[model samples]
Target: MTSLTLAGIRKRFGKVDVIRGVDLRVADGEFVVFVGPSGCGKSTLLRMIAGLEDISEGELRIGDRIVNEVQPAKRGVAMVFQSYALYPHLTVRDNMGFGLKVRGVPPHERRQRVEAAAATLKLDALLQRFPRELSGGQRQRVAIGRAIVGEPDVFLFDEPLSNLDAELRVHMRSEIASLHKRLGNTMIYVTHDQIEAMTLADKIVVLRDGQVEQVGTPRQLYERPGNLFVAQFIGSPKMNILPIEAVAGKLPGQPKTASLVGVRPEDLELTEPGSGFVDARILISEYTGASSLLHVQLPSGQVFLVAHDGEAPPADTSVGLAVEPGRLHFFADSGRRAD
Candidate 1:
């Protein structure tokens, strides 16, 4: 019953506002992620929950207890930092049990908890190794193991995989996902990577400039974004935005107030000119093994991206871009999503 509730949470550094009126709920055993570009206050919000940062306003509840003034150790939350903050002089076993020792847990019980966590993280073979002797991924696992031994009610991860190589990051993502399944603890992870947000989170909170842009599952955000900013932010190649006039009289049942239209690169297909809604000339084609992304320029000088799975056409080739009527996204003049 470690559900969390944050109501109108705010943070301020002197007169500067860093987090503004954020309200969120996290169910027990849920994997929630906070994602945004750098300096968007995602990490700051996480710190507030961890008791490392003071909350300037509103209430924060963890299982019916308000913890605004609670010390971090008493908050029943464990944080796995990005830097793998392990002791230089201590081995893995000692590092994992150091907190318990400080809190006056009996040495035998501390050893039991440390051994249990080490086995869970498959660090038994490296128990005697120092942080310097372990690889980056192994050190990260040790950090996670250290947190696990605390038996926290909530787990917080702050870009734990940002330092790993691409291959190792992918592997760590897998390991973290499996860890969540096995532990079933309420976890909040922060990252700037949308792919990680999509793959890892049960629900995602998208932030921008210290504000939450939207909150939804990955498919919900991708298929029905709340506004212009989210539509472009959640996708890989990003949803392409075009002036509504470009789609004039093309889409059926288009919203009357729509000032812009969005089409995903994968949704636009190549067709013979005059047969499709958009007539454009290919300027560049990028091949990335599975597909080629074609950049095309319209007569109005607007460049649009289209992805093709079959053989890619050469550069300078003229092509028509076709999109299904239902596949189009309309946005109002205020940048909000429109029907």
Candidate 2:
């Protein structure tokens, strides 16, 4: 395993800069995830680390070596791409061992490595099967196995689960997470899926428009976002942003500079009409098994979502909602977090 360092990393295409200066550190054996919307340059940055894309200006170090100019193969890194990228004609065993063969590993050693990786991924039963013969999840496992046989110091995954069905994605996610715990290899994953990032990463680097937005653990990002963008991006059903006046008298010790207040869907609880922090009319109620999501509209015409347990009140029902003062997140007009 190895640590990775990016100091002032940058990538540009003519006049358009795809990756602005970015500095990050990944300690040995850490699972770091890069998450953002499409075209935010997460994948570009990952490719730069893989040496597939040239750094416009910056230093990249894998462990202690200045690897800015090191070739991808020589960087001791293996990449599992968004696509399965498995050779259809090759059997599972052959596909996993292909890299070793190309590097001229003796046939006996290559066989040992292939068998080991297959065993690790539970692909031994399908070693002789072709890519066309396996399910999507199996193919992805083959792709990961291919990288594992390389015994890379760093493993780079570029949205490796986006191709699978929702159920399969969840299963593969567990597989990958278990793999990380068992092998303890240094891993860097890039995905636009925040839920995926939350589940797998020890640290998440949130990016936006080629710039670093926030870097924190899943709980830190969700509970104490550094900015409005991160506040809205990290959670499902998003955060409800309301002008401070909406709950002016309801909160105590609110910063005078705060222009906006953010309340997470799960934090708001429905109460008797006119009895809580604010009053609203329930516009819609969506039952999602354990919890029902209530879409309530304030008198000001703004809608907020509340994740409520128990039976959902009917639509257009008058209700009051309250969130603990500690759970409310305040932001300035500039959208930066405010105390």
Candidate 3:
């Protein structure tokens, strides 16, 4: 296992800067995930760490060595990409042992390593099958097994589950989590899916337009986001942002510089009409088996979502929305959180 450090990392495509001055420290055996929307540079940063892209400036260290100039194969890291990238003509055993074969490892040792990895990935039964004969999940496991045989210090994944179906993705997520637990190797995963980040990471790194938005545990980012972008991006149904005046008198010790207040969908509760701080008319009530998402439009024309259990009120019905003062998140004019 190895720890990774990025100091003032920057990446540029000619005159355009894609990754700007990122600094991070990943501890040994840590499962760290990078999450962001498309074009946010999450993948670019991962590529840099994998030595697949040139770092315009900054230092990258893996363990105790400075690996900024090292070749990908010598960097002590293995990368699993979105595509399985398996050879159609090669059997599972050959594919898993290909790296070892190329490095001139002895035949007996290669067999032992390949068999061990196959057993670990539950691919022992498929060793004689070709890539075309395996299912999507099986193929992915082969790709991961190939990496495992290399005995890399760190494992890097770039949306490795994106191509799988929804059900398969969930299954693979658990498989990867279990693999991490068993291997205890440092892992860096890049994904646009927050759910994946939330479910699999020991720590989460949120990025936006080549900059680090925030870095914390999944619960930290969800329960106490550092800024408006994080508050809106981390949660499902997203946090609703309203002008401060909407709940000006309802909150205690409201900061004078607060321009926007945020309340998560789950934090907003339905109350008796005229009994809560904000009054709104229900625009739509979307019933999702376990809970209903109520889209309510405030008098100021802004729509907010509230998660409700049991039956929902009919559309066009006026209702009151209440939120605990402690649950409200305040943001300054610049979008940074305000105390």
Candidate 4:
């Protein structure tokens, strides 16, 4: 296993800067995920780490070596792309062993490595099958097995589960997590899916518009986001952003500089009308089996979501909502989180 370090990393295309001054480190055997929305440079940064893109200005070190000028193959890293990228005519065994074969590894060693990887990925039975004969999940496993056979120092994944169906994505997420535990290689994954980041990563690097937003563990980012962008971007149903005036009277001793307040959907609880922090009328209630999502419109005309377990209040019914003072996240006009 190897650690990775990026110092003042930057990427530019012509005059446009796509990745701006990123510095991060991955510990040995750490699972680090790069997560953000589209056009946010997450993939660009990953490509740079893989030596697939030129780093305009920065230092990239894998293990003890500076590899900014190293070729992709010599960098000792393997990449699993969103697409399986398997050869149609090649069986799983050949596809997984292809890299080793090209490097002139002995036939016996290649077979042993391929079989070991196949067993690890639970693809032993499917090794003789071609890509067209495999299920989506099986094909994805083959792709990962190919990377494993290379015995790379670092494993890079670029949204590898995006092509699978919803159920398969979930299954593959577990599979990948298990693989990480078993191999214990330093892995870097890029995905727009925050759920995947939360579940799979030992550390998450959140990016937005070519810059780093925040870096933390899943719990840290969710519980104490660094800024408004991260607070809103990292949560499901997104945190509700409301003008400070809406809750100024309800929250005493709040910072005077706070211009916006954020409350997560799960943090908002329905209360008796006129008794809670804010009053809103229910606009719609979406029943999602385990819980109901209430879309409530505040007096300020902003709508926020409340997660409720009991039956939801009917539309047009006025209800009061409250969140613990400690749970409320305050932000200034500049979108920075206020202490």
How high is the CA lDDT of each candidate model? 0.94, 0.95, 0.95, 0.94
lDDT of 3 by residue, 150-265 (tens): 99999999999999999999999999999999999999999999999999999999999999999999999998899999999998989999988867787776899899988999
Instruction: Give the higher-lDDT candidate: 2 or 4.
Output: 2
Q: Kindly report which residue pairs in candidate 4 clash with one another.
A: none
Per-residue error for 309 in candidate 3, Å, reads 1.2
For model 2, the local distance difference test gives 0.95
Query: lDDT of model 4 at residue 16?
Result: 96
Given candidate 2, what's the lDDT at residue 338? 94
Query: In model 4, which range of ten residues has the least summed lDDT?
Result: 244-253
Question: 125-145, model 2: which lDDT tens digit per residue?
Answer: 999999999999999999999
- Once fitted onto the true fold, the runs of candidate 2 whose alpha carbons sit more than 4 angstroms away are none
Model 1 residue 113 distance off true place after TM-score fit, in angstroms: 1.1
In candidate 1, list every pair of residues with a backbone clash: none
Query: Distance from true position, residue 52, model 4, in Å?
Result: 0.8
Model 3, residue pairs in steric clash: none
- After superposition, candidate 1 runs with Cα above 4 Å error: none
